[model samples]
Target: MNQASSTTTSGSAAGMHPREFVAFIAALMAVNALGVDLMLPALADMGAQLGVATANHRQWIITAYMLGFGSGQLVYGPLADRFGRKPILLATLAGFVAASVFAAGSQTFAALLGARVLQGLMSASTRVLAVAIVRDRFHGRQMARTLSVAQMIFFLVPIMAPTLGQLLLNTLGPWRFIFYALAAFAAFVLAWSSLRLVETLAIERRGSLSIAALGSAYRLTLTNRFSAGYAIAAAMTFGGIIAFVSSAQQIFVEEFGMGDRFTYLFAACAFAMGVASFANSRLVERLGTRLISQAAVLALIALSVGHIAVILLGVESLVSYMLFQALSMTCIGLCGSNFGAMAMEPVGHIAGTASSIQGFITSVGAVIVGSLIGQSYNGTTLPLAIGYLGIGIAVLGVVLVVEEGRLFHARQAP
Candidate 1:
């Protein structure tokens, strides 16, 4: 096995042996997803069994974790750049594992939320580091291609994680068991990562991590109109996913009357979306992220409009709304990976910090944004669709700013 790390590889890189690199990146991307997805099946029951009354509070379980995850990225990114990716990563995993144990043993929903918050706070390192790894290993189209492939596999979590959580819920007879499983999974990753990983960030390459870097990272990203546009564009799009994460279980089991079948149904929707994203990764380079995103944003808007229309038109069946929502999610498959790559392209000097900022906005800001959108649920899909339409317009506008032209009329992305 070649343990030699090459920093010179290009897109679809040959002689680079993409398999291990791919696995490593995918694993990194998926770490945070595990905490998010695995706990989904347990959301409803966890609320009830853990003494959470007023279903609205239950949504916070997901939102609070994301909130912490977002906040923690600011610290992790600089630490990785200033210290080293591996050390920061291992330390974060330790926090995640310990928090998971706390969550599993918690006596109440509030206690469980505290643990989830801690778990998410630490796990934030993995998310930022995953993107930083891309910066470390490749650049330009090569980086995009690598990220797309890695993201494709990374997406499989949404596809199977809920179902797996449901299986644990049924066999183990309580929702807390899911955290036990999470602890085990995090522990395994921590062990494997410690043994196999090398320092991706060169020690001498780091700049001062003073508050100045964070401010500078933000300034550079925002001042570069193209990068800012892309970053905001990615945030607008992925915020929808965050909205869904906070509310899908509630919508399925409570609003839609799906009962325990929520997990199975949730998994089905996630798989459909994941498949679309996997396909997008393959075609993005050829299609161009700008063109592809334009199409996706347009399609997502159509789906959102159609959803509201279908509901107002008396199409109240679960399958009716589910199909439209599922269709809408296909757009997510396209937006998340490409938008992410585009955003990170320009901030190479502070790639780790840029990643943290990106994750911070997407996860932290998204939680606040997504929570507001999720809380507006009025026994209909309008709130969700309305959320999508608003975000879609914002995403479209950001793309316009990024491309420096009207939608579809931009001859080339700026």
Candidate 2:
């Protein structure tokens, strides 16, 4: 291994401790969340400012970003594997910053949508390379624990981003300033990464930049039963979460009548997710990913079914809805990192390509599912509830297939 790669694999990068390493990568990954969540508060204002007529058309902003994000991952994964993590990350961060600036200055809906797409394209590197970097340093249950910790930190962004965006929209007097703030934040992250982040992919381990090599790497990632099955299961679960995110503002503000309190309520649910992730980080080594994830999925399915029943029976108070949503978010937190770690466990040799393909599948699937769920809003929570239950059951089926009908069988932790 090269000196830079060796340093990262030694457990610290650029003299940073493990906790700081986790925080750094978490911040990078949170960029994607911020790009999506922070805009929720400003969506109405942005749509108005950009001359959008239909309420549902505003969702195209998010869908466009997701489409670009998913497609861009395919390009970055092989490049990261061919080049190095740090360089690819730095380059993408720079592009992300530029795209944010363009988005801030966009005068039309079309221009803004284009900018969002470019921003998502650049942000894809943060997701792909961060996972690749983690895989470079850890494997198996250790990777799961590390990812849980990172996700725990990442949930903080979603918890506060809407509130921050709302404050900016109210105080700054325009929605464009939110994009400007994103640009500034990206610039800061870029500077921090450039100064501190070290290369994780060793030169000797770098894949070739040939089409044949890329094709083989992708084939290896897709053909592995464990990896493919877990990836699909993860994608389905993620679809449920994305659907909630996309519809959250409408559900909380319009259906439940939370109005201005929506941000706090959303943050509260996100805090539940954060707490779950932290607990998963602590317990994954002992309980194993399969047991924890399977239990969580089953719980999610039950919660979704019960919530839907409550809605149908006319007992769906705001309190009850929040309660169910919080528990569901917690379940998602438990499943997410575990599924990711299990999917990547057997595919570590092609970590970048594997991470890319997995992310592409999950992001695209989530976007389509989320769009369908979000657009189905009829001033009621039934669509979201049904989405959750349906996706959760699908995820469970995929997991069962991955484990060959086994649900909670514990394997030795690596």
Candidate 3:
């Protein structure tokens, strides 16, 4: 399909106005974040009630969901490519609603985890479809800017979800209500998307669902240097994010004694990310995605070093932790959309499968990386800091190789 109208146009070239399109896609993407965050405050309680013996094992709740989310992307991408984006998205959202209800009613920890995995498996479509649809409608700097804006909006969920979840737990009885809330919100998104989201994948652009066609699309995506490299780099960065999330309750509530303040602290960090995303949206087209994201990666490495120094100096206080965490998240915000846009830039012809493969790699790889850091949590921030530092160095190396030792060179429009 022809590129959506120029980035200068009022509405997206994808048929929806910019405001509506970003909001819709953001809401869709937020579904995944909401499913994750809304359970944070309740992890301890859920573990206690479900007879989970070890604190570290409670993280399995998050890990299981992530695994399902990652693997499900591999399936949705090819199906969406064959069937179309809208239908697949709607079906997945419907499944997400059912899964939420199933989770809410679980009588055992194993059953609850099973339901969460199913919920994540279904919600994976939102990530795949949102990226694929944007690829269908935009490219290059336009794509980067659009994703930044959507990320800005999507971060709202992370900022509010923990608080919302905590509120429900305090006022609405037990942790089960959190799952019900997830169901309610997802149902609304399902209804809204069903009504407003136009199909960006033109019928002529739809790919075959045959195994050979699927393999070829995935192969092309993996073989493309920019696509594969940026995806891996992004995955490294995401590992830091998931590590923070998987161990957040322990770090804030158990280690720092934040109590009810944990959600607010989390919200502060998320708000910082949201602010950075908005800044990236405005600046990416002007400064270039490579220049901005590369700078952010370097900044993350520096911050990680400082963070580790503070931890080792025995000066690790809540205030210091909050400042460091928020700043680190700011760097992540700057990097994420740009990295994704760069990866998708070279593979628009197979946007669905490409999005799927990349999403799977980033999600699964991040879970592995995050799991290592999370499981190593020992009532300290040292592990998390080291994770960020390692990820930053790895990402920088990959970017250097991908760009052939070049850095910050902007791409002209095709």
Candidate 4:
């Protein structure tokens, strides 16, 4: 019930209760995932209506948004520092709603892609500001716990969003209405944020835009050998996930002939990620981040190799594909957080800038890798399988260079 807007309280963030603050932050994080996952089931319908014929070309719907999202990450943190969080956040949320509406009304594929990019550019604020807001409220273990809880909520979106989009497509009988649903969700968030949020950055603490300083921080982030290696490795690890998502619709619906059941199977594949994340959380403290993540990478390489062998031997089936997909996804889930944490470990002082830059790297870099793999789809899962193997090897190569030919060492993460 407290309405006071002070950022000094230890128990509550500003004036809102702790639960509300966490939920609000989690909701912000969820919007980014929802933006991506909610459109998966509708991509086919959108492509047909927009006259996009090639199955791979339809992935541009997802790729365009990701490109914008990746590009936007570099600016939002610095902008938030200079302009204060609330104003910039409110503006971006409004932009998100408007862009969503624009997308909903698009008559051509190009126009829809442009709108989706704009929507993604606006939605980028949700990820930047959500973490920034959490940092403003808590530190150390509390901060970690808050992020963990928010991420738990964020992970749920991928599991359920495809099914939600399928239902919308079924009832609304058009894919554009999915954009309308997205717009409505953004509007609700905008209202909730406008009504309840307060400025977290203090006037004295507000930073001026300094290109030299920003560049220096970026330089420092990239120059740290171990951190840089982990950052790139993490991005490569994420690339596999992006590739899977980009091609999931085509593989499930068209190639596998799953039809309406695509969402259910897709959801099952996504579920493996959540389970792996849970297992990682319980095991990381004892096993160490490097060891577990390295193991996962090895598993990815092994799974991919085995998958390709099966395909070559003419033993591939929908069940085999799903099994391999789920196992690979589980590896990615295990790698995602551990690799990121390790990458950030050496850059604690410049965590914000490092996060922004690393986020850009992961997203844009993954998009590049995913686009290549997705475009290589040839009525078989071989390309995706190869993509996963490549990712695993690339990660291992980077880790070797950074660790001096080491794997699963007990030494502390840099």
Per-residue lDDT value at 257 in model 2: 81
Q: Which candidate is the best by lDDT?
A: 3
Q: Which whole-number lDDT from 0 to 100 does residue 188 have in model 4?
A: 87
Q: What is the lDDT of residue 247 in candidate 3?
A: 95
Off by over 4 Å in 1: 1-6, 9-17, 211-215, 408-414
**Native-referenced Cα lDDT, model 1:** 0.78
Off by more than 4 A, model 3:
1-15, 411-414
The collision pairs in model 1 are 11-142
lDDT value, candidate 3, whole model: 0.90
TM-score of candidate 4 to 2 decimals: 0.90
Q: Write the per-residue lDDT of candidate 4 for residues 29-120, one digit (tens) a residue.
A: 77778788898998877888899988789999998998988888787877776777788889999999999999999999999999989988
Which candidate, 1 or 2, has the higher TM-score? 2
Give the TM-score (vs. native) of candidate 1.
0.92
What local distance difference test score does each model get? 0.78, 0.87, 0.90, 0.80
Model 1, span 1-414: residue lDDT tens = 111244543223322246877887788778788888887877777887888877777888888888889889878887777887788889889888899999989997778878878988988998899888778776655667777788778778887898888789778988878888888988888887887776766666676778876688778866877666676777676778878877887788777889767877877777767777677767766766767778999899888888878878887578986787777788877777777777777786688878887778777667767888988876667788889989888888778766766665424333
Tens-digit lDDT track for model 2 on 1-414? 563565356465444678788999898988898998898888888888889998778888888898889889988888888898888898899999899999999999999999999999999999898899988888888889989999999999999999999999889978888888888888888998888887777687899979899888888788887788778888777777777877788788878788889899999988989999999999999999999999999999999999999999999988998899999999988989998998898888889989999999888887888888888888888898998898888898888777778778975322
Root-mean-square deviation (CA) per prediction:
3.4, 2.2, 2.0, 3.9
Task: Spell out the clash pairs found in candidate 4.
Answer: none
